[model samples]
Target: MIFVLGMINAFAANPAPPSPVGRTRPPPPPPGLPIDENILTMMLVALLFGIYIIYNFKIKQKTPM
Candidate 1:
């Protein structure tokens, strides 16, 4: 399956280095995201509220002909 091929490729891409005492080196820390967490959360909430207001004003149908 595709999952098996992906796993094989992942292992091949980053192989473990040989050690005389059979010990491996620790991995480096991961890179950070583009935006700060607080700003990202605020932007997401604003976007959701804007979408809700737009949907209610422009998309919703009124009752009675």
Candidate 2:
């Protein structure tokens, strides 16, 4: 299908490059707000909540009048 071919082309065009051959350290977060595991957890929870709301809306729309 055209969609499948497009996806393949997209992936081929944006292939991830290999990492540099040297010692690497993670960059520090911004000064104001520190990005830590807690922030990541909250973001994940918010994302899941958004998905749940959208799913509920779709289910309600599908029910018989």
Candidate 3:
């Protein structure tokens, strides 16, 4: 799920095409982490939540009613 979402986001951030007023190629993007912190934090929360849900399901099967 994340991989798909990431690919979508990558495609969404596409920069403008090269301009005739300047160089033929767009300047390289600024350095540092490619994604925003909030995006990573959200992905982490989603992954952890999935684990939590699966853990609960497994624990329920081992417990008495």
Candidate 4:
């Protein structure tokens, strides 16, 4: 009973913030890197690889694999 009511309230609740003027917000500034999606993906991949390396060395994998 309570679970169903909670679910109904959750679904009925407002999903977005209320704005009187309903003006659309401006787009965010681009990253400092190149303006291409491929370059952005590559940069993110490299960053994740570097982070994984650091995490493995610091936290997990006591011995080098």
lDDT of 2 by residue, 1-65 (tens): 99999988998896676676663875567698566849888999999999999999998886668
The TM-score between candidate 2 and the true structure equals 0.38
Model 1 Cα lDDT, one tens digit per residue, 1-65: 99999989998896677665855766678878755759978999999999999999876778777
- The 10-residue segment with the lowest total lDDT in model 4: 18-27
Model 3, 1-65: lDDT tens digits are 99999999999997997666957777778987756758988999999999999999998886668
TM-score, per-candidate, Cα-based: 0.34, 0.38, 0.38, 0.34
> What's the TM for model 1?
0.34
Separately for all candidates shown, the number of backbone clashes (residues 3 or more apart, or on different chains) is 0, 0, 0, 0
lDDT of 3 at 8: 96
Cα RMSD for candidate 2? 11.0
Candidate 3: clashing residue pairs, number? 0
CA lDDT, every model vs. true structure: 0.82, 0.84, 0.87, 0.84
Reference-based TM-score, model 3:
0.38
Is candidate 2 or 3 superior in TM-score?
2
Candidate 4 residue 32 Cα shift, in angstroms, is 25
Query: Which ranges in model 4 have alpha carbons more than 4 Å from their true place?
Result: 1-37, 60-65
